[model samples]
Target: MLDRSSARDEVVRLTRDLVRIRSINPPGDELPAAELLAQRLKGFGFETEVVEVAKNRANVVAVLRGRGDGPALMFNGHLDVVPPGDLSTWSRDPFAGDVADGKIYGRGSSDMKGGVASMSVAGGLLAASGEKMKGDLIITAVSGEESDSIGTRHYVERNTLDGIGGIVIPESTSLELVIAEKGTIWLEVNTYGKTAHSTQLEIGINAIEHMVATLHEIKSKWESIGYAKDPYLSPPTINIATIVGGVKTNSIPDRCTATIDLRPVPSQEHPKIIRAMQEAVDGMKGKLKGFRGEIKVINERLPFATDPSSDFVKMAQALGPSTLGLPLDPPFGVNFFTDAAIFATKRSIPTIILGPGEYDLRRNIYLGHQPNEYVKIENLEKATRFYYELSRSFLK
Candidate 1:
């Protein structure tokens, strides 16, 4: 049996240690955090390797061997945290890992370090227990999840998934079993026009005006198309995130650019959406004079879902209540995407998103990338137990 008190203390300590190490995403310095986890896993008799994805960006892959050859169960979490914008807005140091009111406060504490720590500690405890199982338990602490899923993407590209059966992403899901998530398609649109004096309105085309018309048309076209609704997820939506055009107000702008974020459900196809957007732009060409524009794909990730009836999800549901001391609710979906977009969909592996982060928006708690981020100590303990129980049951 695992020592509950000891595991709780170790998880709290590990969470604090991880928070103190700044692995902010813009510069993505996750090497130190990766090394910390690597060393700890190594101490637990795991075959550990630290793979550097970029300069000062690293991923830690560790495996606790099973007695016989069987499928491996993988647990993945990202080490990178979004930058803490404007430190003055915080009541405590974002990196201090301060403990008060039965909560651990820090930038990444709730977003993921808390989940990471709990899973890591659970793995360590399981290793120490020397309980023989049928398959290996693989743990991956990856980088570059905040900006792009580069670390997990690189891991998928370079590694083989032959022996891995299913994956569990300990993201901030408030311990909910998330079986489906929306995918993302980021697009950059650029419009070009001749530059001239502001007074010469007839000679030079206004690129900003052209961009406005293009956006209106695209929105209208998308809204007009009928889409099938997903039972678990909301309807696919598009947002105009950012726009930049003119350098000077006195001159007609020569160019304008806008970045768009389109989130699609599993029922929607990305290529078709892209085609429709292009068609909208093409239609503007004939209707509006000198409306020259092009669309470029910045990034894309396909949405993924695992059948709730699958054995893996069923097992998770079975273990949920006993492990977390709460009733297991129906499997749900999330709007945000995760590395699972690559890890699960690439090979069609069964995946689940469950973690300790406070996701209930009504509670007015800080979540990922928010100021005054925190994770309740009670949730951390519950998550550790849940991971431990789930891994044990699944690997057996």
Candidate 2:
């Protein structure tokens, strides 16, 4: 029989084990982490699956079926994390999963392994309790969240969500629930010009100059056009991520390109946004003699939102605060996107983001995706209890 303290220790141990695996995202290889999670799930009587989405990247899906028919609740989290840059800057090994001073330090600790472990342990507890749940409890440790969200997209395409009532994405939110988030689109802008020696400035149109001028115009009006406002989210914004042109300093190159990252609110249609961006570039064609521009969309994802009054939202809102003995913050929006959006938008599943990662002011501990990334064991335990209590009602 597992007592509360023992269960907490188990969750902490699982988190440390997961952190020890190096599942960094540029070349995301989550199979090792997926295998570890699968082993734990299987030991708890879950029917587990290790799904390979790419060469060495895999997602682990574990299911604990109920005896009777009821709404299915899915707990989701990613196994892959952003690369821990410059290891020399870290006080402890980023992959060591070092437990020091009451916290686990590692690259993925707060960004999500803590949340994943909590969800996994919560599912295990439910299975071990032997209570007859009315519905299925699904736990998914997905890959590629830090990059393209390939894992969740593949999972949604293959799995049916007809019977699933809600999804809980245990992304680190410091325990405050996130119900909505912004969408994103990546664009590449290209400009054309004639190549000529630097001495003959008038003989060739400068592609970089033309591109810079066009971007200046776009930046001036970008926020005002097609901007969507929300009580919980900031207005949509655009950032110029990269630019490349010319072969050498002395040449007036024939080609130049710029990459853009645009975040749109829920009301902005992707097609319309693309059109507006294209028009911004095309409008420059006649303005500059012997110069032309083109806009190409590299990637895109939709913003996600769910009815605040839905049974799923109410269920999470009621459970988290009650379990943690803290006042719950109102459901808010986040600027960044997550795999939760994939499930909410693609599968039409009501999804909520709730987990640990809130910065503890007193402890001087910083959050995820940085040097010395760590998660408090107390927060991990609380998150596990929160998921357990929420699942009990939602899966009932």
What would the TM-scores of all predictions be? 0.96, 0.95
Best by TM-score: 1
Per-residue lDDT tens digits for candidate 1, residues 1-396, read 336668888899989999999999888899999999999889878899999999999999999999766788999999999999999999999999999999999999987999999988889878888888789999999999998878999899998877888898988878878888998989898899989999999999999999999998888877766667876688888899999998898999989999989888997788888898889888988988888999888989899989888999999898887888765558778888889898754688899999998787224343879898999999999999999988898888
**Decoy 1 TM-score against native:** 0.96
Over the stretch 134-188, how does candidate 2's per-residue lDDT look in tens digits? 9999988998999889999999898777888888887777777778888898999
Q: In model 1, what are the clashing residue pairs, if there are any? A: none
Question: lDDT at 187 for candidate 2?
Answer: 90
Alpha carbon deviation, residue 319, candidate 1 (Å): 1.2
lDDT of each: 0.88, 0.85
Worst 10 residues of 2 by lDDT: 357-366
Q: What is the C-alpha RMSD of each candidate to the true structure, in Å?
A: 1.7, 2.3
Against the correct fold, how does model 2 do in TM-score? 0.95
In candidate 2, the residue pairs with backbone N, CA or C atoms under 3 Å apart (3 or more residues apart, or in different chains) clash, namely: 174-358
How many backbone clashes can be found in candidate 2?
1
